[model samples]
Target: GRNEKISAEARDAILARGEELGQALAERLPEVEQLLAMPGADQIEVGKKLRGQAQPLIDEHYRTVLRLKPRLAPIKAAVFPLKRNHDQLVATAKEVRRRLQLGSEMRTVYDDTGAIGKLYRRQDEIGTPFCITVDFDTIGQGKDPALAGTVTVRDRDTMAQERVPIAELESYLRDKLRG
Candidate 1:
């Protein structure tokens, strides 16, 4: 399910971007043709301008488009239990990862082998955009009832943490990735 959906979305996005590129070049075709129809000196001047300015713009545009692609994203998110010892927390984390995978085509990972800090670092090294940690708070074992069913979502680049309810986690991640 995820494999097919992700691959299809990836294909469609690439094709759409490619079409956009083609249209962009087509829009400039008339101008290029007019420049080429001029005298040899004018043609040389136009070529110089294109090489110095237009080519760099096109290259940058393509790079930006490529970077924005979701399929190219290594891991959509990482899931970790606060510690490996707690069976319940670990199970919750696994379920969270499973639910996220079901909701979208993005890749999800579950890790319960290390300390939370180390897990976060590993995820960062692997280029994961977000890390979700399930702790006692997630299972209503904590004093704060308000934190029940919520996980700590950490940003890879920023290392920022936000508490997000399990029910909304997938949609929140999708929105964050989209933006």
Candidate 2:
């Protein structure tokens, strides 16, 4: 099951950091505007420059929070079946949620291709970068656990899917989420 206490702390830290950064950006809006209007660079160049300047602030915030407590980062990915008729999908989602103690923030995508887009949007909104989906292809052709093997793990940022053995799912997710 989800660890309520740890999850709450993590959520609080993420929100607090976001608010702090928002306020800092607001205060610097004038300078940022000035920088944008200063030179011959195009909008894309200006954006790149701004992003370079902004990266350190983001890094600092991330480092501080992670250093303070690492478990606060929410689930970086989620997997659900497209069809509601599949009990496997529901069961997987429930288990994942319970294990992560994710509360109600986890999203379910009813369409396979659409899942990538939805996951990306959510990741942008919440600063996550990965999502996974278990489909018919994942279970192979067997109903038995011994026969059922690899699962499809999707990368949110790259939109890549690889067939990973079922036994490696948990550890793989942990490593990806940690990284």
> TM-score for every candidate vs. truth?
0.60, 0.41
Tell me the tens digit of each residue's lDDT in model 2 across 16-122: 44345445674565444444343321223324555566655543333321121112445455555544467776465445435443343333232334544454445
- Give a tens-digit lDDT track for model 1, residues 46-141: 344444544444433332211223445777888999978888988898999999988789789898777776677676666777889898999999
The TM-score obtained by model 2 is 0.41
- Model 1 has an lDDT value of 0.70
Give me candidate 1's TM-score against the actual structure.
0.60
Colliding pairs, model 2: 2-101
**Model 1 ranges off by over 4 Å:** 1-71
Per-model clash counts, in order, read 0, 1
